[model samples]
Target: MDFALVGLIASLILLMVLALKGMDLLIAAPICALVVALSNGLPIFATQEQGDIANYSDSYLGGFSQFLKVWFLVFLTGALYGKLMEYSGGAKSIAHWIIEHVGMKRAVTAVVLATGILTYGGVSAFIAAFAVYPLAASLFKQADLPHRFIPAALALGSVTFTMTSAGSMEIQNWLPAPYLGTTPYAAWQVSLFTALAMAAIGIYWLNRMIHTAYQQGERFILPQASIIASVEAEQQQNVNPLTAVLSLLAVFITAFLFHQDYSNNALVIALVAGCVVLVVGYWRQLSQHFTKVGSEGALGALIAGANTSAVVGFGSVVKATPAFAFAVDAVTAIPGSPLVSAAIAVTVIAGITGSASGGQTIALPILGPIYLDAGANPEHLHRTISLSSGVLDSLPHNGYVVTLIRAICGESHQSAYLALAKMTMVVPGICTVLALYFLA
Candidate 1:
């Protein structure tokens, strides 16, 4: 391997290590980007004397700015939209409804199903986690299942099949459409099978793990008093389940109807419409909490957008290096269907970046033309990249996984990550391979 490539790989590893340590990406990303710049002989900053040289400002910040330019609105509206569903009791309403219908006898199944529904329905995965968790805790306690598996159940629902499925409200599903000139429903036939296989296999594995824990005499542990109190408070605000479902439908139906001409703009419109529905549904309560909701939502959007862009900046710096060109050549030269090469390239970048959107945003710009020029089906590439992005992007460093395990569930990685890995990484990985075979 070339020395620059070695440096690139080492920088990525360092970034992952920093992520696992729970350092803020806003800080970690730039530090690692500097490493890539220095090691690759890129300039630290472009000056008047060296106006055209790739540097941290031109490369890293340029990448970062471009991501925000393109995606800030999506993140902004997505966060506010999720917050509306959350604050107006829409998400909780749906969670309660699912739990009521599914019954507590199958606690693990209920959590997974509820989370999947909320996520697929256009609620942010973070919001869905918060909404369902109170219900999930109560269910697990009542059903006598161990609490450690809650993160896994959430991951299985939020990130695996639901996140990558055709027409999913997830950004991952939408990211490839613009790049490949395909819709989110690209290759619907293969995506349908991939999603079903992922869900069926994941549900089975989650249940089997719970059963084993039961056989070992494991039982649910009580959560903190504050956690219990929050659940009770959440139960107090009971928005109608129908209202909740409508809010979700607004996003999905509008996006589906408009995605062809508007592309990702459809998502922005859909999210705004969803927010409007929730605001109307909960107008009375909005008087009390409207400002707080907007502020919090915007803040959340800022954080999420900045975090993704930081990683994208790192990708930007890496992209300027000769090593990146070399790596791309090697990946594209792989002797197989262009779909196979696309999958490998997308998955590898997603894994390295610890972000699906960040990875696809970086790789697709370069790889999309290559595969399309080679006569690969744009729809196939869209589906392949979408599914592949979900695969290794869930390593322990992934922001969503880290948040779910530690921030939401209050469980350490050592206790919860094994189950999460199985759901997010292993199951999706198997389904991705199956997708490649079918698409091939």
Candidate 2:
């Protein structure tokens, strides 16, 4: 193996190891990127770089700044909107309604379905996690389910089927379109089948794990320093469940109507609209909390966005390495069916980058034309890579996985990642394989 390849693999391993050990990404990402740069013979500064060789400053900061610029507002307003729902008691109201109608025993399913509804409706998964987690915490506590499973349930709904299914507005699903000359709804029949299978299998796996934990006497255990206030000086004002749902509808409906022309900007608008509805619907409760909500929400937004951006910077450095190019070449050259090769290629790259969309963006441009020239079906290639991108992308170091486990759930990776892996990685891997076989 090339020395650069050795550095790339070692740096990824070190990154994940540090992440599992609870090192902050803002620090760890730069440290790991330095390793990649040193080993790959890239210059530390742009002024020192030779032709076509990316320097650490240019590549790392470029990815970091680019992600933040694109996503920070969405994070800001989404967190603020979620905070409004939490502070106003709207999320709790929805939880109570679900308990009454859906029954407490089905709390896990409720979390999954609620998140799926939001994600499929064009809500950012980060936003969906924020919006649904307060409700999930309430439902899990009421049902006595272990809080550790919360991350998995949220990920299962947000990242698995809903993310990669045909027509999903998620970047992973739609990313292959321009390169493959296919629509977002490419290979609808296979995509739908794979999606449903993934959902059913993942839900079953999650519930089974929760049930087994319950049998072993494990139960809901809220953290001592929980982000949610266990008690408040001002009693939570009662919010009507139906009326509270209007806020969610605002986000979904607005994103649905304006997505084509506005794209991600529509999500920012949708989240702001949701916040507007929440403020109006629960003004009596939220009016006094407004200053606190905005400050806290903005802080949360910075933390989440910065954490994910740190990893994106790491991926950016990895992308610049000769090893990444070599890996892409090696994967695309795999013998046999283009569909299988494409699926494997995307999955491996996604794992390496710890991002589905990142992997697809890198791989499709190279793989698309190769397979197309070999007479591959564009729609099949589109759907296959769509599903494939979601598979290995959930490895422990993934930005979403790290954010979901540590930042959002307040659970350490040690406690939360196993269930997450079973749901997001294993179930999605199985479903993708099934799609490949059927499509083959």
lDDT of 2 at 292: 90
Compared with the true structure, the alpha-carbon lDDT of candidate 1 equals 0.88
Q: Which window of 10 residues has the lowest lDDT sum in candidate 2?
A: 228-237
What TM-score does candidate 1 reach?
A: 0.96
- The count of residue-pair clashes in candidate 1 stands at 0
Clashes of each: 0, 0
Candidate 1 lDDT over 134-188, as tens digits, reads 8888888778898999989988889888899998989999998888889999999
lDDT of 2 by residue, 36-125 (tens): 988998888865336555888788888888778877887788778778877787765664565456666888778888777666745567
Q: What are the clashing pairs of model 1? A: none
lDDT of each: 0.88, 0.80
